[model samples]
Target: MSDPHKKIARKAELSKISSSFRRLSSRATLGAMVAGAAVLMFIAIGVGEHLATLALRENERLIGNDLAASVDKVLDGASTSSRANVKTLPGSPCIEVERKLAELETHLRYVRTVALVENGRVYCSSALGPIDVPLSAYVQARRRAKDITLLAETPFQPGVPVLAVFSSTTSNSGVLYIIEGEYLSDVLVHGVRYGAERAAFAISGNGVLDEKGRFHTAIDADAPYSTGVTSRAWPFTILVASSPSLMTRQRWAFAVASGAIGLLVAGLIAAMYLLAFAPRRLLLAAVRQGLKRKEFHVVYQPIVAVSDRSVVGVEALLRWHHAKWGPISPAIFMEEVESSDMLEEVTRFVLQTALAEMSALTPAFPLRIAVNIAPRDLQRKGFVAEVVAAVRSLPPNTTLVLELTERFLLSESALTSAAFSALRAEGVRFAIDDFGTQYNNLDLLGRFPFDYLKIDRKFVSQVDTVGADLIAGIVALARPFGVKVIAEGVETQSQHDGLESVGVPYAQGYLYQRPATAQSLATSISSSAASAQH
Candidate 1:
């Protein structure tokens, strides 16, 4: 007999462990989700900042292009006026050339002084009545210089920086015009209003004129992203110093929104894991693996007639020789499985194996092979078809009897009745197992068509004292329905004798035979055949 106390204690321990595991699993899941979400959020923010900086860098390049266009416009106007207007000065007298130079100076934009240079000599000026200065005094010497020049100071105004533009009319003669430095600085400095922090204009080799009207020989190279746009119309470049502060603001805003999205996705994944895949996964997976590994098999216990003890049939009982646990009692696991969906897999394993094993036998007499089934399997559509397939595999000498173990009621509806009728036509039979124990057996017998009633083991164990009168009454009640009675668990000779005294016809228990493997049964058959031959 199985140890009932150990089974109860094992079940209680498993329940307690399952509860603890569930709590631990839930907390671990939450922590993992939070860490995963945080990682995703940080990655998203980093990527968002990178993309935003690229866009901002492109924007700054466009702003520099726009500023370059403005500088082109101003230089284009200055170039046209310096050549066409200054050449029209009177050439007759010095005083007249000086008056014409002053008038041209007053009309030209950004011009400080206009002078005439002939054969590398500056002879006249606009600000002074007469002047004598070499052409090289204001700029580097060139025979036909048509370029810009930077002057830090003049003889008259001591320390005022100016630009000299020479537009040549001949190889050695050209008009010399001086331009104000402040106006050039103003055009370059306007970039501050757009995005740059510091703005300046750099001449080819002279100096850099900054936004503050000051000049330096070299510009700062360490400034972040110092952008330069060279003028196509002049011999200088516009430079602006930049920082990432412009894109920083927009990057942070986009990062916050992306972080929120990451959290929502993590929450959805965690919810799906808990709801759809976590609970009961371990037990179900183990059962599925157990089936694949062929850990389960069937055994048979012979049933004998009460009068002469002749072996008439056998009841097929499922036995599990687990690889890890080694011979688990069905009582410990069956209750849990009956309450779950794995009951069908277990039932089909026993049913198919028992039928095939019984069909392989060539016994001298007809044999009844009974297999137990749970009530829930009858409600399935494919169940009847599976049974029909297994039943057809048997030979004519063997009969298959299904004993219904009613953990739940097998409904007596039209659909179920049709299923039973279809199988009954194929010579399949039914027995109500453990009758008069968990439910009202008399009501059950009237509701469904049954061929046999198996008396529960509790009644058989106590037959001499309490169950003797009860078995007599149950056998009397079963007589009108044409139902036969089988008393189970007949352990002693006196119990068997008592069953006979009560007129029970068929029985199965340890007093007659214990459950044995298919190989054992075959060995017994071979020995009996050898004895008969002698």
Candidate 2:
């Protein structure tokens, strides 16, 4: 060494340079963190605004439904009264009928007038004055009512508010028409204004503005007609117009609050990054700790045969227990894993655990285990080989059923087809889960091999009067394919009977048994067997 003092000075200089570099790096990191925080804040604000708008739209839709139902009830009552006495009353009883009609008019004072049509003429009225106008004139004037045979609201005149309710009665002789005009301006001015605190408007089927009328700018240029609840019903639309300025004000307030919060978060992140790398290090440490713990588990749901009510299969469903979140549904956590590369690890773990469980059960029943395969996993390189290896390692008696859902099947059809074929070669079964959901390509069904098709729970459960014909059609289609049909969500005895009668061979639903642990399943089977023996 040239000199001991020189060596010390050199070391000191090196330490000082290192300290300066660290300070510069920390400042750069702080800037990046601040930028990232600003981006995240912007994203959150966008999502919040979108969700709020969606909520508002849904609220409007629900309110409209409620209003429609209430109006329908009123129309029903009026129609009942009109049909009950219109034909039976003689000319002498006209006075009595007029008195009754006057009382009915009082009952419906909110209504402008109620007109009854018989023999293609306006025969009776609610008003006490003599009916001087010709029936033909009234009929021609009320041609709009003829177009809307069902109960509906239409604007009678420009600016003047009116609601038209039309109903028809069919007897052995011919059809009789009843029409009632109700003033909706009072209802709109009082009811809707009080509730929503906004200007309200309604429109008729002919695109005529109601209440405020043709002069009002409530109706937008692009407003479309509502097909109503029934398809055969006339085209009618409801428009509720409010001040656009109020909406703008609310949006501006939300934006300002969001921006302020975003700026504050950015400042906090900047400060933290400038001070230390504590937050990043903490996150990495937490992730590493989680991987080491190996706390993920799975729950099983039994799939029973409908005809015999025997446990034929169990679907292995993933479950996660976060130290903070307790038990989390797979639908959520699986999505997070799927977005990352850790999904393969999760699949391997599930496969191993499920196989081990199957091996452990003494005198293993001839049961199939259905596992949902994510499309991403199928697309992974060497995925098929890995799955084959896993299957080969499993016990001979265990039958693995791969359930490909419509979402996964729709994308990468060719890849999924190849995967299915390869798995089938290894003695594994394949099923199209939630079948009859969407219009699937029949050509694909013919070309690709599928062992079973699980009918969607919605279609299966609705095998009553409304859906009876549809269910019959589906059953008929499946019959030729020779593929066993398994109906899901058979909740009631009536539903079970309906499916069984319609040739649904198998089913999985709560009516038979809910999902249970391995031990609980065994106990359930034992109880069921005991009951059978008795």
Best by TM-score: 1
Off by over 4 Å in 2: 1-292, 410-415, 438-443, 525-534
lDDT of 2 by residue, 298-407 (tens): 66777766666767777777766657535545654454566567767777777767766765665455567777776677777788897788778765556787776754
Please, what are the lDDT tens digits per residue for candidate 1 over residues 1-534? 479988999999999999999899988977887788788778877877776666666666666677778756655556575566666552335677788778877877777877887777777888875777887887775533367766666777766777777776666667777777687777766777776676776776776777676767677566434567777766767776654576566577767766666666666665445434555656566666878999888999977778777666779998877675466567756766777888889998999898878676666335678998877777776989998988787876567888987546665788778877888987888888888777555977788778889999899998877779999999999999888999999999889989999999888899877899865776544443332210
CA deviation > 4 Å runs, candidate 1: 1-279, 363-365, 523-534
Worst 10 residues of 2 by lDDT: 170-179
- Tell me the whole-model lDDT of each prediction, alpha carbons only: 0.74, 0.57
TM-score of candidate 2 on Cα atoms, chains taken together: 0.44
lDDT, residue 483, model 2:
63
Top lDDT hit? 1
Find the 10 residues in a row with the least total lDDT in model 1.
Answer: 525-534
